[model samples]
Target: MQFQHPELLYALFLLLIPIFIHLFQLRRFKQVDFTNVAFLKKVTIQTRKSSQLKKWITLLLRLLALACIIIAFAQPFTATKTALNTEKETVLYLDNSYSMQAKGSNGPLLNRSLQDLYNVQLPSEKISWFTNDVTRKNTSLEDFKSELLSVSPSQGQLALSEVLLKANQLFSNAEASDKRLILISDFQQNEAFPEIPDEVTVNAVQLQPVNTNNITIDTAYIASKNGNNMQLKVAVSGSGDVPASVPVSLYKGKTLLAKTAVDLSSEKKNTTVFDIETSGNLKGKLELTDPNLAYDNSLFFSINAPKKIKVLSINEVNSGFLQRLFGQEEFAYTQQTQSNLNYNEIPNQDFIVINGLKDIPASLAVALQSFSKQGGSVLVIPSEKANLSDYNNLLATLGMGRFTEKVSAEKQITQIVFDHPLYENVFEKRVVNFQYPTVNSYYQTNTNATDVLRYEDGNPFIFQKNNTYFLSAPINLENSNFQNSPLIVPTFYNMAQQSLAVPHLYYTIGQQNKFDIAVQLMEDEILKIKDSSSTFIPLQQTKANKVTVTTIEEPATAGTFEIVKDADFIASISYNYNRSESNLQYMDIENWEGANSSASISALFDTIMEANNINSFWKWFVIFALLFLLLELLVLKFFK
Candidate 1:
């Protein structure tokens, strides 16, 4: 029992005034009323005695009425230990991973799970939903239905830890009557489970889908060891009690390269080895030939074409450093002694490194400028032996602007642009040790220069403009002490590959896009992705800061997409996927841990009522007040 408002008990103090008045009160009557004198004295004394008794009773009734009024104001309520009227809003967290496509009694595991949701007699009380892949909080039944309808089984695997983190965050601010979390998953026993938060009560729902007679090809790789040209082995395993033969196919783009079938048994795993000759655009898909196992039918994979990059280094013939660095087979390098070489006759090459070209010839400058503008890259390492004025003017023409007189290199520099693409992941930590071997004199650019490395005096040492890059030091191995440094290999490779050549696009199968293709950062302002008509669509990244575009078209198909940035193309992306959307089965509740757990939904309501004890306590006091009013009436009528 609790009082909703204990303060109302103060009304009992009013009863003291009534009692005092009744005890010490006096009344005056006319003398004629007792005219019977001596003869009527005895009879009058009896009546007076009755009148006094009635007065006392009336006063008592009035006091009781006052007490009742106070009690009523203090509103009393009962607190039941168990649920008297149990009603709960159970939040269902369903895991809709690709593995959920396993078959079950209710059809595919995922579909069965959804049907089970509809089966639960969730009261008129609203329901909230969540998914392992998506966040759903404070969601109504309709919203849940909508999300479920739109949910396609995802390809990316989610860690249990990440799922729990999202679930906790979603329910953090919920004000539901009684919150319950019901997780439905296959519960792949090998995976680690995350710790549940104390505030939330977790109920794990176990999936018992039909066991698959599956033989999946885990992976296939190619290798040639010690002049032995042999195809590598590919592993295959059964996902269930039964196993059968699975067919594998190798392809170059859409062309079939090879095909074979391997038998798999339930008792043991099997591996299939094959050898093939291929050139460009190779991909593979493995499929189970068994008819019963349709959900895990085919798995797709891609392998990149072998790369052959060539470089043309033009400089004086006596440059021993250039000769040594270019000796490696990793690059196909061609050396030209003439600085006036024509680029038109130059063969197809990935990069062009120009050395000792003090004043670039007018024709060569035009060719290099056009090449860079057309998405090719060039690294220009200047020399102290040539004309600085002509090169400085050339720098202005390339949009890098005029250069000031060169400054001597120091042992260490300040504010190295570690965040730049060339250096972002090149080093585990900051490179604190760097010695400048050649203090080559040169003019510094005043405008349009992206200073990659800066000295303590704030002078730019390494900078880039347009597609052309300018290194303050000679890249030739013998000319500088850079090759002796441990950071030389990775640094040079990363700069040439990443900083110079723009990346193709980034695409993740089965994951939603991070950035919308239409959106751009223009003129220092955030802009939305819009069509030519200026209609906007929301753009967001899936996980990385890189943009992901969610095309309304069939995203399961393979295709390439280009991203335009700052009038420069940074990366090219390709979408290659075949997302499966077959199964819809649910988990079994009987086998789940804490399945028989009992909890009263009304306990929370009791807690709220207890906090409002003052109000409830007054209600009981009020009922007493009403009873007192009735007693006062009886005393006045019947006693009179």
Candidate 2:
């Protein structure tokens, strides 16, 4: 309680004057003529005593009335805060990630949260609200009502620590304003809670699911190829309760191709394989019935005809091993001697090999530089008796290290970089005692590229930098036997394979996904991706023979989409929502430091309103003064 007019409380001092008058009366009773002194003495004693009692009662009533009126004039009041003049800003972060689809008391957790939001009376006239993918600033309830209704599960989830930074962006730049942050989410266990700023009060509302059991189709992929048919493998996983078996279905467009069941009675994770016999493109989807989360219940994928990578080799001393490795069925192999090679065919290949060239011409070196810049890959195997000037010129122009002096030594290839992308999924285990190939005599070069294979003495046997690869020694059967080793197939195969990255079963949304389309387009032409609902042009670049498309956040919806060049359907691709949300575990909201936790949205808003209310006591004081005056009059007129 506080006083509004504290200076007016000086009137309380005047009540002391009434107290002085009650304590001592200054008037002496006038002397009257006395008659019958003996009889009047007894009556005088009784009358004097009664009159003194009445005077004391009247004095007490008047003092009480005066004190009440003085307090009423002071105008006291009670409030939650000391100063109520500061401006208030509120920012609400609502998490609409896929995990919100879990079931709660009423319905889905997201739907229940929506209803809770609708019931809240705004603490202020306006506020800012944001989700994973959208933001509305300083908007009234009526203004953001539509946006809230349209909020769906999203793949772009922000970590709990990131939410604080995102919400702070919407706050006004007033230094004296009171800031409030309201975070609403399921609070998944993987994210860390951030510390709250002292200037801003944080309120967290965590929604819990009644049942945590959820069965999800985790992923789908082509596990193995069976002749013309492929063995499609689907992995399913669950949390909490375990069912005996879950039926899985495979779909090509809308037609059902095959069905299988994954027995989950004994394991939390299981797999089911389907032998698909289709030979052409398949707009495929894998589906299962899961009562918990609908987002991870279905997986979308695609199977398209193989696109062969083009390989060109310009030879000075031709070796027949290149033709056997780049089989006709998979790679379009073309071999041309330097004397007969046409420069027109340079830009049309994906991977080019300068095979054991004794000397490189200036024209061929210039052509290789242009090709490398346009997304082509090159491998240089230096000859024993080569022109140092011409070979160094080509290497320098391609942003690679130039060869200096030749060192004649017998060395063995003893190291392999199994962690490189070229060697991904190639080795089941690291082999240390395998047969190491040796070179009889080789040239020593100075280069700062990643070593694909190293010698026993730590010199680079084969090094690569970006798209340009170099072999430090010649492999002409007379110099080295590296071509006969088991490492040769995967080493060269993956080098070319990575040059044109093939599209996977599905790409996660909100990530950097890039792939190539093997189609030649005219200048100024473009490519777009579309499904049944919408179409969008991804960030793309046209190389000499293919288009490299990169997507970061486009194709927002999860489904099968086709890459279209003008009117032609180039290939099919797919996108899926992230599966991290399928795990039903939740964070411990009670342990969050420096934050006030609420059970629901409506309760949090009610608390805010109550804190800012000011209860004034001036009116109640006025009523008290009037009642005291009535009591004083009654005591004076009726008590006697």
Candidate 3:
């Protein structure tokens, strides 16, 4: 037992006032003669003894009542521990990721958690709470109740370690107080459960969904494109027991373009294909009806009008191969000799190839360096029977390694860097034991760059610097047969494709996505990605002919947006939420050792209430005081 106001206990000494009054002689009684001497004396003695006994009983009752009253005012209570003396700080970690859209007993899991947080009673008035993208410190339940009522699912998901770290940072380090972190989440099975700290008491409330079945549109890609038709393939996947087939629809701005059903009866993963018009801009949306998570049900995408890449070749040899590869439909191929080359046309081209030049003019080297700085890509093919001194000087000027001397030994181009971004979608599988291309006579260079293709002896057959690609030997028919090999198509085609880096079918949100738009922006002008009524200006860099746009977390909602420069619409691009949370799998936090886990948030509040174990005795003390006073009144009225 402990007293709330223990100093009031000193008032107990005032009980001595009643004792002094009872023991001291304050009044004198008159002596009287009895009519019968012996009988009178005996009766008087019995009366005096009865009077003394009644006085002693009344005095004891009065003292008991006064002590009870004093103790009641002192506010005594019994507790199991001294927890009341320490201040408590609570930090709530509420998980509102897209995975919480799973259904629980009431409704969606996230909605149920929000309702519980709004209704559950807490011991402290001010608590710190954080969600995936929202945080508030020392806030009242009433103050955040409206915010909780309007909570929505987010695209961000923090791992357990990140949540713990954020929670610990919210606590104050200057004060010595009891810190507790209440983690309310669905506990998705995406990350590991990190160890809890000793100073903080962690109580986890894991919400369980009614079922784990979910179907998601994993991704979409351009399978193939013909004359006027494009084939789009979408990959669908499911968790738990799925249905036989799901209906997938293609819409262009709310107008249905095509409809198809994916067969999921035989396998958990399957693809469905649709063919649409190949030309023009397509603001496309692929949708499927799902009862589980809705974020991944509809995927937005765009297919902008095709922009031909500008390819230029400064050649001294026959240019038939370059013309054949860079067709008139896809590339604007321009061939110019050394004397006829126009330096002003260099800024407008996307890629430049210097092929078999006998001499590198000082003015040409300076022009290529300036073009490379303005985001133009270059590929240098050295010339046989060439001016080695001028070529080495050009290489040195461009920061490419100098060519030492020519080697006559034949070398096979055997290695390919399939992982490089230049070959990103080129190879379906790594090929081995194929007829490797060979170079008869090649120049050996001391270049320090990432080798894209290596010789049999680990020498660089083809290497790439920042924006320049180098072939160690010339690929003319007289010197090498690499131009006739099967690798020539994808190698030359992908290099041009990656040079411009046009947008994909769609990009996932909350990721670093970079692409180029060929539209040139005026000075002091910017590009905006517009979604509905909101517009976001992304991080951009302007080059000579195009603007490079990079987006991470803009236009936060997933949809197809328009890239607008001032008022004119340049093109359409798409963003979608990450499908990582599409699979409705949960972590088993209930069986975690040394954790205070609960499913009901209200129950956790009750547990906190019980943990204190403070049974107040002040009211009981008042009742005891009343009972003692009643006894004193009875003794005074009936003892005589």
Candidate 4:
């Protein structure tokens, strides 16, 4: 026990006044004669004893009253481990991440946290408030409460290490002798706590949810597409040991496309495939019937509509096979010799095939480099009698390796990199002992590029670097049989198909914020993204022909959105909630031992007050002092 104001204890000397009065009153007594001797003697004995007892009682009451008053002014209290000091600071970290939306005893865990804050008895110290996305310092208790009313579950997730580091920085320059951090969170297992410093003490309050069994649509992607029919694969995951069977639905704007039941009994993670007929832009969602944790139950996705590809063949010696391969109904193919090539049409083409160009012009090399840098793909087919220096100059300008020399030895294409994106979903099964393309003579180049097709002698037959693809041998009638080979169709078709910018199927909220659009907006036109509920203009920056837009304020809900320019639909975008908050596991209380933590807010406040060492017992002491004085008054009034 200790006194907050010990100087007031000196007032205990006032008790001497009451003692002196009692001693002085004893001397004022005088002797008296009795009328009857026998009666007077008996009465004197009884009256003397009663008078002495009353005086002792009265004196003790007065002394007790005086002592209680002095002790009340001294303000005594019990001390804790930390000694009380003048200045103190408190930092409160309230987690508002999406994981706090889980149900608790009262309502949502976030609501329970708010109720706990309302019942907290704040000390007379500077208070700092921290949330996942917002931070305010030196706020009053009332102000903090008012701000908390407007806070909701946020998509941004803050790890425990980040919160601790911020708290340490906030208290680093504090002049207070005792600094404390109060953390209120669901303590999700996805977030790990870091080692805390001993200079500042931490008081953690973990809020546990009622239900931990949660099933969510982890992710969805296109498995395969054949003509108009596409096989969409969706991965589902859960948290607890309990098995569950949930219904999964796919929707396209208000129309239900398909519905199926998924059995999550044995596997924690299961991938289900759905076949659907799609036309134009495919915008939809994969939803599961789980209301407990609804944030991750639905995933939004969009697949862009197919567009016609424009292919331009710049040839010095025209090859009939090149035109027949690219001049299909889906492609707008045009061929021109190098002397008759128009530089003005370069930007409009998706792919440019330089076929057997003996000499590449300086101006054409610059245009090709600019075209490749702006997301255009280039396919180079070198001539057998090509000028090595001219080809090397063009290759050097385009950041590709130069052809060293021509080899006379014949080689066959024996290896193909089937795992490359260019060959993704191209074959149903691997073909073994198949016929290979043979080249009588080819260029022997030392290029550090991804070898998509290797020769029989381990030399590169076809290599790619960024948007540039190099074929070692030309498709001349006397030189090679690559044009007639089965690999010729997909190799050229996929090259032109991949040149156009394809919108991503879906983006995870808080992870992807930037997107590139292939649209070339006019001077007066501005791009805007909108959903059914809200619309906003994003931060746009133009690079070459493409425009990159970054979301300024991300949407609160996940769904498919449309990007429009002047009321014309440019493309579709989809967003889904981050899966980090779907896991409901948390840290146990036993793991948090010795961390100065409490499950109840009131108990934590009591501990902090004890640590302050200034618990005000003065009010209770004053009540006792007044009661004692009342007792003394009763004794003096009635006993006399």
TM-score of each: 0.50, 0.89, 0.84, 0.71
- Which candidate's TM-score is highest? 2
Ranking by TM-score: 2, 3, 4, 1
- lDDT (CA) for every model shown? 0.55, 0.85, 0.87, 0.81
Off by over 4 Å in 4: 1-78, 81-83, 124-126, 175-177, 241-244, 309-340, 351-358, 372-499, 543-545, 592-594, 616-640
**Which 10 successive residues of model 4 have the least lDDT summed?**
26-35
Task: Summarize candidate 4's per-residue lDDT along 407-512 as a digit string, tens digits.
Answer: 8988899888888778888888766567989999998888888887889788888889987898888778789889889898998888887775456788777764
lDDT of 2 by residue, 1-640 (tens): 7887888889888988977987787876544557887677767777778878877777776777777777778888777662364688889988899889898988998888987887778777888999999888999878877667888878877887788888778887787888899988999888677787777789899999988999998888788786578888889998999688899998888989888889988878899999888678888899999888899988999877888888998887756888888875668888888889989999989999999888898999899889988888898888888888988898788767878877787889998878887789999998888999999877677888888889988888888887889888899888888889999999998888877876887899889999988888898899999988889999998888888899998888889999999889999999998889889888888898988998788888888888877777877877877777788788778875
lDDT of 1: 0.55
Q: Write one digit per residue (lDDT tens) for candidate 3, span 1-640.
A: 8899999999999999989988996776556787788898888889888988998988898898889899999999876552574678889999999999888889998888888878877768789999998999999878878778777899999999999899999998845688889988888888777888878888989998888998999999988888668889999998888899999999999999989999888878899999888568999999999888888899999999888899999999987888989875768889899889999999999999999888988899889988888888898888887788988887787787878999998889898888887777777898877899999988888988888888988889888887788888989999899989988888777777767888889998888999999988789999999978799899999988989899987868899999999998998999999999987878889656556898588888788878765788989878988998898888888878
Select the stronger candidate by TM-score from 1 and 3: 3
- Model 3 misplaced stretches (Cα beyond 4 Å): 5-63, 66-70, 78-86, 316-325, 356-359, 383-419, 425-465, 471-492, 609-615
Which 10-residue window of candidate 3 scores lowest in summed lDDT?
78-87
Candidate that would win on lDDT: 3
Candidate 2 stretches with Cα past 4 Å from truth are: 4-28, 34-75, 79-85, 171-178, 192-200, 317-321, 409-419, 427-466, 475-481, 484-487
Better of 1 and 4 by TM-score: 4
- Measured on C-alpha atoms, candidate 4 has an lDDT of 0.81
Q: What is the model-wide C-alpha lDDT for candidate 2?
A: 0.85
